[model samples]
Target chain A: AQSVTQPDIHITVSEGASLELRCNYSYGATPYLFWYVQSPGQGLQLLLKYFSGDTLVQGIKGFEAEFKRSQSSFNLRKPSVHWSDAAEYFCAVGAESGAGSYQLTFGKGTKLSVIP
Target chain B: EPEVTQTPSHQVTQMGQEVILRCVPISNHLYFYWYRQILGQKVEFLVSFYNNEISEKSEIFDDQFSVERPDGSNFTLKIRSTKLEDSAMYFCASSEGINSPLHFGNGTRLTVT
Candidate 1:
């Protein structure tokens, strides 16, 4: 079984400030990682996904994440936060099951609050 | 862009009543899935369907839950008897393959009263 953890329950940042949301996963083998964002009453929008490749991957809205194999972490980062960036962010890990279907295990999520 | 679509933005059903949630996956996708998130909780996978059969399901998905592709286009999840714990935001997703990223629907908020 695989699990994901987002240590921070809520994060607050001022406009123009840098932001970082941490994520950690427990898996037996190399796993797929994804970042998703959801606003109130909305569906999740994919920020980015990492299957296998360069350790650093870029995503929409100027967000990026670095995959650290040693730490088993895929932390999302943004150099400058904007008001519109405030939303609930989830980190999920995907792995192959006995059925050979890829299933995702999501973290509790970290809520971002951007201050004007 | 092509996206997964789910009908009934919100559903209010009484306990013990059967409720069916509908979804229309992307036209060419081969895999479909159902996930739910309780208020302030992580998204939990319910089941995955492919080729009109269940490929995988979680412990949370019991006999009381069922999924079907009634029409060639419509995928549905039917709960035999609703429970208060079933109240959550149900999301449908589809993907081209196992490695492909899933495209999710806006979600149907199920409120079991």
Candidate 2:
């Protein structure tokens, strides 16, 4: 079975400050990783995804993540965060269930709060 | 850019009543899925549909739950008897291919009283 763990339950950062959210996964093979963000009363939006190739992947809103196979981690990072970037972020792993169907197993999520 | 859309932004129903959540996936997408997130839990996958049939489902999707793509544009999930535990935000998603990134809808908040 595949699972994702986000170590941080909540993180608070001031505007213009760097931010990093930790994510670790347990999978038998090379895994497909993704980052998603959800604002209050909104749907989950895909931030970025990693299937293969580059260890570091860039996403929308100036976010990026590095896939570290040695550590089983895909940590999201931003050089600077804007106030609007505050939201609940989730990390997930996509796995093939069978018959070519793919499903995502998500982490508990880390709630981000921006300080003025 | 194309995106998935889900209907009935919010639905409140009695515990024993039935409920149907509808979704219109991206026009050219071939695979569709249903996922749910409880108030403070991780998002969980319920089922996946392709070729007008269910390709996979999780344990949470049991006998009381069902899915259908009655038409080319709409996918629906039906719960015969809603339980209190079934209340959650239901999300619909679609992808162009097996390995393509999934585009998700805003989600329908279902509340069972």
Candidate 3:
């Protein structure tokens, strides 16, 4: 079984400040990691994903995350955050169920607050 | 860009009543899925469907819950007896092929009282 842990439950940052949301996972093999964001009343939107290749993956809305195998962590980071970036973020680990299909196990989520 | 769509953005039903959530996946996608999130909790996967059959399902998907692709494009999840605990936001998603990123719908808020 695979699981994800997001250490921060809530974080607040001022506009123009750098931000990082921590995520840790426990998986038996190589993991497929993803970051998703959900604004109020909105569905989960894919921020970025790491399947294979470069350790750092860039995503929509100027968001990026790095996959660190040694740390068992895939943390999302932004050089600067805007007021509109306030949202709930989730970290998930995907496990292939075979035949090319997979299911994602998500963390409880970290709610981000951006102050202007 | 194409998107998966779900209907009845909000639904209010009495406990013990039946409810069916509908979704229309992207035109060319081959895999479909249903996920739900209770208030202030992690999003949980319910089931995944492909080729008109259920490819996988989580333990939360039990006898009371069922999914069907009645026609070509519509995927529906039916709850035999709604419970208060079943009240949550349900999201539908679809993907093009093996390991493709999933595109999600806006989600339907199911409120059982």
**Model 1 Cα shift for residue A106 (angstroms):** 0.2
Winner on lDDT (1 vs 2): 2
Ranking the candidates on TM-score from highest down gives 2, 3, 1
| Tens-digit per-residue lDDT, B1-113, candidate 3 | 78888998999999999999999999999888999999988999999898888889999999999999999989999998899999999999888756687778989999999
lDDT of 2 by residue, A1-116 (tens): 99999999999999999999999999999999999999999999999999999999999999999999999999999999999999999999999866666999999999999999
Which residue pairs in candidate 2 collide? none
Candidate 2, B1-113: lDDT as tens digits: 88899999999999999999999999999999999999999899999998888999999999999999998999999988899999999999998876788889999999999
Ranking by lDDT: 2, 1, 3
User: What does chain B score (TM) in every candidate?
Assistant: 0.98, 0.98, 0.98
Better of 2 and 3 by lDDT: 2
List, residue by residue over B1-113, the lDDT tens digit for candidate 1: 99899999999999999999999999998889999999878899999998889999999999999999998899999998899999999999988876788889999999999
Off by over 4 Å in 3: none
Off by over 4 Å in 2: none
What's model 1's lDDT at B34?
Answer: 98
Q: What DockQ score does model 3 reach against the true complex? A: 0.70
Q: Is candidate 1 or candidate 2 better by TM-score?
A: 2
Per-residue error for B26 in candidate 2, Å, reads 0.5
Question: Interface RMSD of every candidate?
Answer: 1.7, 1.1, 1.1
